[model samples]
Target: MSYISGARKVRVMARYDVIVVGAGIIGAAVSYYSAKKGLKVALVDKKYPASGASGACNGGLSYFGKSGKLLQDAYDSLILYRELAKELDYPIEICQDELFVQLATTEEEIAELEKNVEECKRFGLDAEMVSKSTLHSLIPGLSNKPIGGAIAQGGLHGFVNPFTVIYGYLDKVKKLEGTIIPNWEVVGILTSGRKVKGVVNKKEEALYAPVVVISSGFETAYLLQSLNLTLNIMPNRGVVLVTEKAPWKLKKKLMGANFGSTGQNVSLCIEQTLEGNLLIGSSQEIGVLIREPNIDLIARIANNALSFYPSLGKVNIIRAFTGVRPHREEGPFLGEIKEYEGLFVASGHGGMGITLAPWTGRTVALMIAS
Candidate 1:
């Protein structure tokens, strides 16, 4: 394929071993890992890297809230993220401990935390039930209203700078001779019979490849539908509020035990970033496509933050942002599709996209290589 650049039309390779759609964390990680395995890879995105949910998320690498296969997958991904934080050129700000607080009014929630801790231990995770006194010792200024809590430590929880991880992966991909195409929208998937051929861009230019991986997050469903594939990936909008840098430090990330419970209308996750800013989030609203900030949700988040940490009541909220996560009923789609020989999907991680990127990439790369 060739495109005009300035006064000249530059010609580029039309075919590659793999064509990764979307340059967000998932796609970027896939490209990096695949290229490291000596594959000629092409990564294309409608916008620049981290322009999607990867850039908007709070970057909490939490494992305690999840269980069953999801928790196992998160644990596997955490191992890779821990390694990358040390191995990569960039800093991912991986924090190791996470706290789940149970508000005093909810004795039921405190009991749930104890049960959750036991469940986590059964799954071989290091979880401990923190008494109210212990919780106070851990976080001196914490709201005494919380009866007790649980701390999921021993590398079971952490966080990363989502942008840093995305850029870091993209940089490694480039260093490994992978091609990156930004501002290119994939309009269609080009297929031959039952096998995948490549993709067509918005300009109607075709980029051929033997293998194609779709990691386009919220757009995954629409793109797959174009190829006669019915993927039920829904968009769930989450809003997060960022506060100005503060002098105080949080001993650990705080998440309400009831947050994200089924039938619950609102949820809150409060964490202090490595840069000293507090990220108060997030509300899960289903079927919201627009990425605009919701004033009500933002206010709710701020109120929740203040309720948990009274000191933050006066903190200035500098900005508010929203990210639409791709929600699938069957969890994230990974590996090749039997209907299409060369086509694969790695998406639907929802808010956990960044946290699971490393495992997703490694798994996809191995699948493609095999």
Candidate 2:
């Protein structure tokens, strides 16, 4: 894009206080928070926002899914989201309707659900166990196969639409006069000696920025190669199946405790979107590049959903797609790098990227300020 300056047309050079690579939820959040801080920020992505996991998520904002610092970060992000919803121009379908329900058809799964409830309660969340009858009562069409279940009740543990969340952040960033550059892939980091300057795009265009935050999942490693930095984040594929609009309204975001029991890394997560379609997901295939829907894996995911709600047997699958979850052997690595000046890192969030996003962005922004 060029503009007229006095006599000749001048090419509009992109420059910023912070150039955030990867316009996924993490990068979007970082751009939102940084721009909110009155900084010139640019949110650049190879594709559009939420084109990754954010587009293919169940959008369960819960603290019980993780332990240790991860759990705390999830809780903190939930609180931050409450404040964020008011700031964003779009509605991300933030509803305070039902609890996060985990059902157990077997004794072992029931035991696991009980343990999860205990962990939630220990973290000061409102949680409890329910018998088989109570579980059925909570979900009228639910199968009687479940021996019991657990519930975590509170404002922080509701469900949301991931697309809106990502766009919400991006929208606010643009409203704040921050640049949203799409289809611009950062092939390498621009550097001069000890201090980093900007980023080099695939078109060989150099966008200048004093500071850079690499929040792109899996691809972060490729950008870090030139800087001699390493963040061990790998790809784990998950297939999400979309069923036809539901004939009934689902009250809770359901999880089958038999998740990943097949040892094929498939999970039993079933939820109804506000659009009335049921999103059934997923499987964990590590280090695989294939995004094609595996027929067998898709069948397993569908069968798992049917196991929970037998009534859904006739529900035709309208869509099925695979999403790559970021996998890290150790844990997610965050904060600014000491070796590279003005270069920060945020990746390896695995399947919990959306869950951990707000806290990660807030923390990373604070790091940039410091």
TM-score of each candidate structure, all chains considered together: 0.91, 0.90
Candidate 2 regions exceeding 4 Å error are 1-12, 258-264
Misplaced by over 4 Å in model 1 are: 1-13, 97-107
Compose the digit string of candidate 1's lDDT tens values, residues 141-219. Answer: 6776687778877655767888888888888888889999998898877776788878877556778888999999889
- Model-by-model lDDT, in order? 0.81, 0.79
CA RMSD (A), model 2: 4.6
lDDT of 2 by residue, 62-145 (tens): 776566667778889988877777878677777655677888778988778778777777788777889988888788778877
| lDDT: worst 10-residue window of model 1 | 4-13
Model 1's alpha-carbon lDDT is 0.81
Q: Judging by TM-score against the true structure, name the best candidate.
A: 1
